[model samples]
Target: MVGFNGKSNSAKQIIHRMRRGPTLPDGGVNFECHCVSHLVASPCGYEFREAIKCQKAASEGELEEGACADELMNFMRCAIRTECFRSW
Candidate 1:
């Protein structure tokens, strides 16, 4: 007897992988000013990831005052200090 299979093998395919980085937003990491792809490969990638993670973990109302303030601050500082995000 044949066993029943659920998802198709084709379903496991990665349509479009981001530019080798920590999980970024659907399109990319949007800084309001711009969106980045190869962030994980960049200098300030870790800082950005930490900030996003903190923000995502916050409860519904907790973000009102500020949930990931420290993480966000750290990311901002890294960005400024490294000046890695310059417009091409």
Candidate 2:
């Protein structure tokens, strides 16, 4: 999907946007960095990294089978607790 910076969001980065934020004054895109500085400096950064690494290594079957589920869950919890993935 397109990010808030006009960059094409990589599949991996797209995972960071659990929910879409309000539209920017201008349209944009998410690339390797996932766009938001909130995430860049998040306390959840480590969890996010672990999840992405798991996602990248999983095969389609493994991914669908939830091989990365734990990692993703950890990241999600961290994101929520830290409010680092806010849509606002």
Candidate 3:
């Protein structure tokens, strides 16, 4: 079964299979960023949004406090690899 972070032997196998052949959905990691200048200006809203993303990423095995999206993705990749290795 896939873990909370969505990583598992099956997940690895699926990724490998997808890499070997083209398939529907054109799968790979996709990221979305929301920019709310108005909300960021508010102290409570800024804290709330940041907290939500931090918690979500934490639950998904991503490192907290990434300075940028690229850093966050890299952190998640490393975290997933580390978890996989530990499981083995």
User: Which has the greatest TM-score?
Assistant: 1
Estimate TM-scores for all models: 0.59, 0.53, 0.21
Error of 3 at 69 (Å): 23
Mark the 10 consecutive residues where model 2 has the least summed lDDT: 22-31
Better of 1 and 3 by TM-score: 1
* Local error of candidate 3 at residue 54 (angstroms): 1.6
In order, candidate lDDTs are 0.65, 0.68, 0.44
- Predict model 2's lDDT versus the native: 0.68
lDDT of each residue in 1-88, candidate 3, tens digit only? 5756777668677665445422224542112212333333443443434544554446343443443455445445654554533433
Per-residue lDDT of model 1, residues 1-88, tens digit only? 2224553444224233223344355744344322443665579888877877677678769888878898989988998898898887
Q: What is the lDDT of candidate 3?
A: 0.44
Off by over 4 Å in 2: 1-40
Q: What tens digits encode model 2's per-residue C-alpha lDDT throughout 1-88?
A: 7888999998778765654542232433221333544454588867866776677668999998879999989988887887865778
